[model samples]
Target: MGGSGFLGGELVRRSVMDGRVVAATYLSRPGAAAGADWLPLDVRDRTAVAALIGEFGPDIVVNAAFRQSDWVTTAMGAAHVAVATSENGGRLVHVSSDAVFSGKAVTYTENCVPDPITPYGAAKAAAETAVQAIDPTAVIARTSLIVGDGGSPHEDLVRSLATGGRNGVLFTDDVRCPVHVRDLSAALLELANSDRAGIHHVAGADAVSRYELGCLIARRDGFDPARLPFGRRADTDLPGPVDVRLDCGLTQRHLRTRLRGAREFVK
Candidate 1:
């Protein structure tokens, strides 16, 4: 689902490239990508979710639809998708987030239990729980910050800050392992086709702060890295994790697609 967002758009594009019969879901409007059945869906509606999934009866369903601030969309919406997918007898690949961690451990493995500190994190954690409970055989892939060539939100923020289009400071203390959207989408599709079930950590290899990431992006996009303002997340009362990294070692062993780090991709 959610074939209009950055990561979701990539998934739709790749799936279409692979010559699969794709049916992508969108909320506001249809995505620009062609050759797919773009269906409007609000995952919050349980009846609608069930009806759509049942009608489609896809062999595999990837649940990537979520709203960070909305609990019903992120948490309850996931439960509804899980139930529908389960009833339809389809393999599910639910996209999760690293926000589930509290950053107390700095790094987390696939086995790490979620200890969310923010509302968004808690919602993602709850979504993971609901997906797991409803479909034990489902692949719940927990990824980190998703960076793309020039499409992702982080990349946009870097460009805006560097070009004086926006005012913001990249936090040097806020660290994460950012994975390329293409790599992440390929990995998710690979897992969806495979028998790998349960929680999997799919993230980049390098760990870097937001400021460092912005600098890398700035350099790649022909902007002066020096123009990107920086600060420390610790100085602010931001209710989120400071340094959360997902260890994708175990999950990486089984995948042919390499999860390129932000440092490499942005270069």
Candidate 2:
């Protein structure tokens, strides 16, 4: 689902390239990617979700639709998808987030239980719980910040800051293990086709702060890295994790796709 989104669009593109029959879901408008059936779906509607998945009868379903601030869409919508997928007898791969963890653990493994400090994190945690309960065989892939060539929100922010289009400071204390969208999409497909069940951590190899990440993007995009203003997350009243990193060691050992770090990919 969410074929119009950045990560979702990549998934649809790759799946179509592989000659798979694809049916991608969007909210408002269809994505630019061709060769896939673009269907309008509001995951918040349980009946609509069930009807669509039932009619499609896909062998594998990947739920990537979410709104960070909407509990109904992020948490309850996931549950709806899980239920529908389970009833349709299809393999499910639900995308989750690292926000489920507080920075108290610093680095988290697949075994780590979610202790979210923010509303978004709590919603993600709730989604994970519901998916696991509904479909024990489902693959719940928890990924970190998803960066792409020049399409991701972070990349856009970097360009805006560097070109004086926006005013903001990249947080030096806010650290995360960001994964490339292509790598993450490929990994999700691999897991979807495999028998891998339960939670899996799919993230980049390197953990860096947001400021460091912005600098890397600036350098790659032909901008002066020094011009990117930086600040400490600790100095702000922001309610989120400071240094949450996902340890993808165990999951990496099982995948053929090499998850590239931000430094290498941006450069």
Candidate 3:
């Protein structure tokens, strides 16, 4: 585990213990947790990352760090980590994004090759390809909008509505299989321990829309029901497939644990 991001943080906390020493690092966490040995280092800096690799001696490495959370930066970061992890004799699990899908269909399986429609999606798709090329044993866990507690955008919207920032919110008509960060973290670790390295769709239980998901979050958190009304979605223009919801059947059957459903994740 390299990043202490929302999902990444949970993964490290669970996976690292007496038998496992988590090499958790962060550039600037503002404040580090008491138990975590959070380091100040950048993954793009090969030497620093390599030094951490040598010190931790981890059996498995999960590249949950996304560079600038965009295309070029993310791809390069993933490529660098894959190289370091493979050369260091550690298994690699790279977190990928569903933006890689063209969003042309309702759902995508592990079978769907990525046809990225956005810069972020392109980076992730490229990163997946590069990681696979270097080490076919590396696992690529492709996930969508990771929703959870701890000040996420989903939660922010509720806050905004509470303070009356806006009367109606504009949600995308786009459909996605949003996974809860915590459950997804568990699923990835299960895949890692199993040594089952390949492409897998790590998504939530339902194929839902942005509007539906927003309403669900609001309802679950007990936000004002009347103020959160159905809003319109922006028509995004791009050059590839769109709205490809992921089908995680392969993940369901392969891993030891059954991933939580969309509703379960929301809760």
Candidate 4:
């Protein structure tokens, strides 16, 4: 695994559970988990990245090291991983996002053209482009807002809602298909172990709005659903794309993991 973040950390555990020799990396907490040989290396340093890949000699490389600071770090980081894996002849499994789509009244499928608007989306789109350019066999797993037990987008959003003064804001308009971290991790592992190639839409069973999600979380955790702050997708400064619902038909047909909806974690 190239990273040990939310999804990457779970992927590492699953990879080890599947009896695979995992070499995990992290920026700060290298020893966060005990399943893999934690290697402390920064993705920004191409030489160190190359050295790690050359040393580990993994049969398959997962480019999951991501940063939200600059576009170069977010976009070009995937390119560096692709470069490191180029000489090794290993298949690169790159994780992408639904943000790659413009979210302009279209339910994006595996075949949809990428048209990202946000810097994060654009970076992921760029990373996807880099991987496709370097290795056609690389699995670009495009997904939506991820949620699970530990650190993830949902957790952050939940904390924000739970402690947002008195209002506890939420948007009832914007929609997304949030896949659980466990399911996404399993799907990634299955894809890496299979011969399935090209871009695949691995997402939740159904789509729901952020407001509805917040409502569920609030209700589940003893917070009044009515007391929670509610708003529309347009309320936020996040540019274009209110709802980028993913088309997971291909993944549902191919992969072994069962990717469920966001409500699975509400309890």
User: Ten-residue segment with the worst summed lDDT in candidate 1?
Assistant: 258-267
Q: Which stretches of candidate 2 lie over 4 Å from their true place?
A: none
- What is the total number of backbone clashes in candidate 1? 0
Residues 119-182 of candidate 4 have per-residue lDDT tens digits of 8888988989888898787888888877776467666666566767444456677889988888
Give candidate 3 misplaced runs (Cα > 4 Å).
16-19, 30-34, 67-69, 166-168, 234-242
Worst 10 residues of 3 by lDDT: 233-242
- What's the TM-score of every candidate structure? 0.99, 0.99, 0.88, 0.92
Better of 2 and 3 by TM-score: 2
lDDT of each: 0.95, 0.96, 0.74, 0.79
How far residue 265's Cα lies from its native spot in candidate 2, in Å, is 0.9
How would you encode candidate 3's per-residue C-alpha lDDT over 37-130 as one tens digit per residue?
Answer: 6777677777767787877776888888875455545887788778888888998889998878887665788988787766777888889999
Candidate 1 per-residue lDDT over residues 214-258, each given as its tens digit? 999999999999999999989998789999999999999999999
lDDT of 4: 0.79
The number of clashing residue pairs in each candidate reads 0, 0, 10, 4
